[model samples]
Target chain A: MEIIELINVKREFKILNRREGIAGGIKDLFSRDYRYLSAVDDISLKIKKGEIVGYLGPNGAGKSTTIKMMTGILEPTSGKVLVNGKEPYRNRIENAQDIGVVFGQRSQLWWSLPLKESFKVLKEIYQVSDKDYKDMLDLYMSLIDIKNLWDKPVRQMSLGQRTLSDILAAFLHNPSVVYLDEPTIGLDVSMKSKIQEFIKGLNSQKATTIILTTHDMGDVDALCNRIVIIDKGKKLYDDNIENLHKMFGMYRIMKICFSKDVGELDYDSLKDKAAELEKELQENFSGDDMTVSVDEGWIDILMNEEDVSLMEVMNFIQSKQHIYNIKLEEISTEKVIKKIYEGGTIL
Target chain B: MKKRNVKFYLAIYFKIISQDIKSKLSYRVDFIISTMGILFTNIAGFITFWIIFKNFDNINDWNYYEILFLYGFSLMALTPTQCLFDNNWNLRDYVYSGDFIKYCFRPIDLYFYYISEIFDLKGIGEFMMGVGIIVYAWINLKYSVTILGILALIVMWIAASLVMAGIMNIAAATCFWMNNSGYVMVTVFKFTEYTKYPIDIFNKGFRIFFSFIIPIAFVTYYPSMVVLNSHNLPILTIIAPIFSVLFFYISYRIWMFGASRYNGTGT
Candidate 1:
């Protein structure tokens, strides 16, 4: 059974307009100027119990807006969100018990207070059993390695440390689902990895369903098996993250290096080599993200980054004449997003 | 949440308050300076009154000490309000920063989490200064240590303080929408000055407005009227604490309502 469900979840916001000047300001006090904005436009998706799904989108693409609706922060304009068979907005206080959300920019733990104080407050708010509270704390301490920082004030902690505390505070109630929106934003690389590990730990150990919304591709790569991309309030793609690489990011970059400066290649000869390669592929190879350049003691060849794996690229380049150190790398997720942003379709 | 006992809630609040007190004391200069500053505010109020009384002869038949009682009573009535509900000062910041999200996702009532966790020891200074002035005024009023009068004062003052705290929080909770925040307690202290005077000075219309429309009288006027024993204490005075409890529930409801609407923007 699905632990979470959303049927045509939608959200509209009233955009207020103001004419500049004192007169307009006074008039605004008497009457508000507003236009309707459909932030989340008729979105519907479902996650079965214990699934970790990535909610991906560009900035202002209604990603957070959708999460807010599902988490009961914002009520949908035209649809329903059900978590554990309860309407998120109508039964918010009850719905809150079932899910933990850590908004990356907001500190869930009290800033002035120590980390433990915020955890204590959560205990009262959740009414968690004593045994359960201790067990969860123990698990978080292992996951994030923040035992020493427990008594330290939140204001004094580093971004990574604070995020660790926020994550702990969110999950202290042993909630069935966790909603982490950009949970690792602004953290150092080490901290980001730590947060990702802790989240995956919770998902596997507790069978906790997770809806992660983030722009960090590393976070998505590390934690999310399923990716849902939205642009302009519409779902563009929802598929396996690995499959995304196969469908749109299968290209690899192969660079060949020569031991010594290959004496100036004849421009005519290089153009001829390019023409010959184009003909060899019978129109399969094109210079889109592919090009060869000659510089400082080496001739570099860049080609169609495809099914030719990095290992294959290296083996193929190694077998070629006069090649020195050869390098092959898979395209990172950032480039994949660039392709998607430019309206590239994935199979 | 419904089944959770209030005692459990109180225990958590007390724990947070104790933690706050210990943390506050760590900054000793701040602790001493704030207490001194709060005391100075009342001292300023007294000097202002002395200056005015010298000029006016009397304010509607009330003397120096009489006015002092009004001022002291108002100050004391407002002390707990500031001490308890002053934490609501962060309501606007809370909303903008989406800290209320932290409060709402908890299994317990979010309302208790905000009001209970933070304390102002400086208000303790404010509360003590009022106690000092009230003692001086009581002696000047020719009120001996009459057990009945003191007991009535204590009982009425408790109800009055709670009511003031309620009004302060509910007003502050308006930040859920306005988010344009000012000092939660001091900014709207209409009664803190007027509470010392006898309700008689205000016209009947204003008296009704203060008594019910805004309930400012619950803070000082009605309670002092009891201690002075000027007239039979109305049954309505006894009902003030009931209103205090009601205000608390209503304030919590408003706070929780605001808590739900908060969208933590930064995620």
Candidate 2:
């Protein structure tokens, strides 16, 4: 069954478009000029139980707005939002009881209270049974690696520790569904992986439906099997992770360390070589889909695997110059998002 | 299962308050200083009133002790309201900082969650000082204590606290419509200063405005008149509960209206 559903949900906010400065500010008090901004425009989605779905979007792309509606924090301007078979905004308390949400930028825990006290308070607030609470705590302790940090005041804990505790608190009630908005944001490598592992555990072990919103593609790669990408308040792509990789993850990066310094090469000489390489690759590979640059003592090459094979590019590079070492890496999400932002679409 | 038991909510509220107190008391020196500051300020205010009455026998027909009754009753009402609902006074800060979202998704009522977690320990000093002043004034007046009078005072005090809390809620709710409501709250709190004196001292326009429009008079003046066995209008005290309930309902309605507009903007 779908634990969360939004049918044509649209949220419009009336933002006062006031001018700047003292006189403008005074005039704004009586201006009555409001520009309507659609934070979420006709977004319809259904998230199933136990499915870890990544909700991806750029800044101000209505990602948090949709999460707010799902969490019953904001009522939709039009259409319906249902969580567990009830209108979330109308049945807010009931919806809240069955779901947990973590805003990575905000701490819901009491600022001065110990982490354990926050867990205790949330346990009562969600009315989790004693046995369930104890069992969940044990599981969380084993999974998240924050057991020793439990008694420390939340204000004293590091950002990563606080975020881990928040994740624990959100899952304490064994909620049927959870929304984690950038839970791994600003976390170190090890901490980020730990959180991702914990989120995976929650989904696999308890079958808790998880909706994750993050810019960290590592998070999407690690935990989410399906992803929904939105930009400018509209859905751009919604597909399985494997399919996303297969379609848009076509670029491959190659770095070659020369036997000698290449940085001493004149700009004109490098530019001429780059243009010649581009002409050869375009003629040989059937398209101009590669870029070459010299950095330090190494030459870096970025190529679309679809346009030119890695072996072909390597052979060409070897023929042109003496190679010391070579390494190839898949294009990063940073590159993919930049590509998408530049109007690239899944083929 | 949809609706939580009121007892469950009450238990959580107490736990929240106890946790707040525990956190507050951790800064022992700061807590002591804050409490002492409130006590000394109230004491200085009491001395000022005492000196004014020492130079003059009475202001109009009200004696020094009688006016003290009004002063003490106002503090008595104001302290508890401030203690339990102190966060309401800083609602604009909450909204501006986007911390108000913390209250929105809870399984408990948002207003209940907000009011329960905030307990101002400084108000304890005001409460103690007010009780002491009321005891001292009663002793000097030789006022006879009766069960009926005690009941009336208790009921009136609760009603007065409700009125203040409701007014604060209304003021806070304005943050939903406009940002930076510090001015609105300051203005409203300044209006409450007039409740410290007998309404009879004010002109007819001010008295009528206090009685009908803002109704600050009911919070202390009219309620204290009944408790002190003096009545400019006993019917005002008799109808205080009705006004209190009416104001509370209106404020609550206004809060709900404003809360629906809370978009967690700038979050």
Candidate 3:
């Protein structure tokens, strides 16, 4: 059975032009103008149980509007949203019981309380039994490496600590479906990896159906099997990860760092190497001085972000470089998301 | 179906409370400072009256003890509500950040979770001061000492406070749409301030509005009126409980409605 199903869901909002400033204050008092904005326009999607889907879009792409409708937090102006074969908005309680959500930029934990306290409170809300609670807690604490930090106040804890606590709060109930919005935003490399590991563990181990909307492409690369792309209140594409990469035509960004200090590589030198690497991989890579540079004894490489085959570029770089470690990464999920949004043809 | 009733909700409420307390205690200094800050505020209010009464005999025939009694009842009547709903003030922040998703996702009512998070231990100071004032006023009023009256006062006072808290819950819940209409809460609170004292001092219509429509009268005025045995306002004791239940249900529904209308863009 499908864990989530949305058929032609649409959301429209009324625009209020009454600006905040006092300059047009007198004219605004009597006149009330309403404009229509289709925040989520005729979007349809479906996901089966335990599939980790990367719901991607640039800012203001109606990705959030769609999620809000599916969660029953916002009523769709038209169309049906079904999770576990029930209308989410009409039957909120039942829908809610099966879902867990995490907003990356916000802390769900009480700022004044310890991490454990938030967990205990959630325990009662979800009404988990002793055994289930212990099992879920053990699993999360292990994956997230949450130790004594649980005892510390959430406010006093670092950004990493608060995020871990927030993640734990979302999954304590062992819900069947989970929604994560920018779960890795504003996180360091280590913290991002830890969160990704926990999410991956949940999806693989428990077969938890997951929907993640993020600007971070690494999150998609590390965990998701499918990607749903939306832009300007519309769904442009929805399919497997391979399909999104194929349709969007994204490329790897190879950044190589030298062990010893070296002279700056001018735009010509950098472009020459980039083109050479491009031909070697048989993929088109083009950039100017601004896109590619060498500064502070480190080599920075920006390839055609549209190309997906990083392994080819990896082999090419290995054959060429004497020895500094090289880091090759794709353009951010947000950037590929931007290309998909702007109606740019995939290269 | 019957198994999932009030007991189910009460259990969840207490669990959330325990969790909130645990979270609050994590930052030892923040907790102590916030709790202590309430006393300073109360002292400021106390000192204003002290200076004013020091010069004049009384304000419009009310002495310090009488005024103190009013303050005590109000503070006490307001304390429990604040403890329970202080987090309601955060509803605006919650609305913007869409953090209220935590409550909506739970099978239990979001009302309890949102209100419970409104924990503000600052009320402890108000609670203690209120108790002291009530005692002083009771002694000074010098009515015949009876155990039953004291018991009734405590019981009815709690009922009144719950009603007050329920109203705040509704105002706080409105944050779902106004996203920042949280300012409305402060406006409502400021509006409540006018009714905190005896409305009898005001004109006929204003007093009528506070007593009947808004029901700020029941919070301190009615219970104290019962204790003092003043006027012919009949059987308010019975109406108190009925009103509490009615308001709690209405405000709760309004919250659900607002939440439904919530975009949860931060969701």
Candidate 4:
């Protein structure tokens, strides 16, 4: 069943046009100017129960705005936002009862209180049953070693610890839907994997529907079954990860390090050499399915594996210059997203 | 979220407040210093009153003790908002830092959650000082206390507190549009200084403005008049309770409107 649905939702903001310098500042007081910006522009979405969807977007691409509208912190400029079949903004309190939200840049936990105290307050606020609260504590304690953090004030806890506690608090009420905006941001790799494991465990145990907005592709790969990519307030692609891979995964990266030290050349000379090599390769290949660039003394080539094999590209480069090292890489979600941002076709 | 009753809300409020106090008390030195600071500041104001009244017989026929009664009444009226609603001062920071979104995420009233997040314990010192001054002034004036009169005073005190809190809510709500309403809140709150004196000292126009327009006069001056039984318009005392309730309701509506217009800071 659909637990969260957004229909043509849009949010516009009126930003003041602050002028430059002291003189311009003085002039602004007399005649104020504002420009309207559509942060979320007519985006439609449907999220089902127990679905973990990665809401992916580049910076300033309205990912956070869409999450805000879903969480009822923002009322869309037009169109509908329904959570559990109720308009979220109009019925925020009721909607809030059924959902939880965590913004990575902003903490929801009480800064001065301990993790356990904050949990107790949340328990009262959500009216969690005593049995449910105890079960939640037991579940969390069994999954993770969090006893040491129970009495530590949130201000004293490290970033990863605080984030872990925040996630725990968010799921404590067992809300049917949860929104995690950049929850894994700034954590170390091990902590990131641990959090991912915890999230997976909770998802399987409770079947909680999760909408995760993030820049980290690792999180997307580990937690999300479906991915929705957006750009500049427009929906670019929304599909299961496998389908996305099948469509964009044919591309491969070839990194070739030449025995000649390209670092000895100036940046301009290096750019000129890269451009010359790219032109020669394009003329030889006679196809637009490949891109070549120079990075840190290595000539990196990204091309569709179907159009040209890795062995062909490596052999051509090796014949021209003595090869020091060579590496091949399959396309990842990260590279695919970069390609999409570079205006690649969705299909 | 559900159809919660008043008792449920009150219980949750105490729960949150107790946790807030526990966190605040953790910083022992800071807590003591702030409480002492508030106590000293109020004592300094009382000393100024003492120095002024020592030279003059009275200001506009109001004696020193009478003025003390009014001052004490004003402080008592201000205490509830100071202790319970002091978190309104942090609204600007919350909005600017994008922390206000946390309040919206909770399954509770936004205003209730915001206010419950902090309880300024220093207001306890202010309350004790206010009560001490009121008792001292009452003894000096030899005012007889009756059960009915005490009940009336309690009602007026609650009304006065609502008036102060309503004004504060209106000032804080401007943060939604302005992004920072510190100056507005401070300037509006400074007007509370007028409540510590008799409205008769001001000109007729200023007196009318304070009583009707800004309503600070209703907070302490008019209420004190009713207590002292020297009120020319006893009807104002009756209207004070209703006016305070309506004033708070309107202010809450303004806050809700501002909250709806809240465009959170950039991600």
Instruction: Give me the candidate number with maximum lDDT.
Output: 4
Top TM-score: which candidate number? 4
Superposition TM-score, candidate 1 onto the true structure? 0.83
Candidate 1: docking tier: acceptable
Of the pair 1 and 4, which is ahead by TM-score? 4
Could you give candidate 4's per-residue lDDT for residues B96-201 as a string of tens digits? 8877777788878778778877778889898888888888988898888778767888888999999999999999999988845789999889999989989889
How do the residues A1-347 of candidate 3 rate in per-residue lDDT, one tens digit apiece? 78888989888898767756786666666658768899888888889999999888778778878887788777889998888888887877777777888878777666666777777766766677889999997887667668878787777888877777777888888888898988988999988998899889977878989999987888988998888877777777777766655543445556776454455445566566655544544443323211444534445554564433456555656776764666656555554565566653322
* Each candidate: chain B TM-score: 0.88, 0.94, 0.87, 0.94
Better of 1 and 2 by DockQ: 2
What are the candidates' individual DockQ scores? 0.36, 0.53, 0.50, 0.55
Better TM-score candidate (2, 3): 2
Best-to-worst order by DockQ is 4, 2, 3, 1
DockQ winner, 2 or 3: 2
Model 4 chain A — which ten-residue stretch has the worst lDDT? Answer: A258-267
Best by DockQ: 4
Which regions in candidate 1 have their CA more than 4 angstroms from the true location?
Answer: A17-34, A141-144, A253-327, A344-347, B54-57, B97-99, B144-147, B179-187, B202-209, B212-214, B234-239, B246-267
The parts of candidate 4 lying over 4 Å away from their true place are A11-37, A258-299, A306-309, B230-233
Query: Taking the tens digit of each residue's C-alpha lDDT, what string does model 2 give over B1-267?
Result: 535778888888788889879888998999999999998998898889889988999998888888888898999989877799888877888788877887787788778877776788899889888888888888888888888878888888988988888888898899988876889988988898888999889999999999888889888987787767544547888899888989988998898778777777633
- Residue A330 Cα positional deviation in candidate 2, in Å, after optimal superposition: 1.4
Candidate 4, overall lDDT? Answer: 0.85
Q: What i-RMS does every model get?
A: 2.9, 2.0, 3.1, 2.0
- For A69-183, candidate 4 gives per-residue lDDT tens digits of 8887778899999888888778788888888888775778887888888898889888899999999889887888898899998999999998998999999999999999899
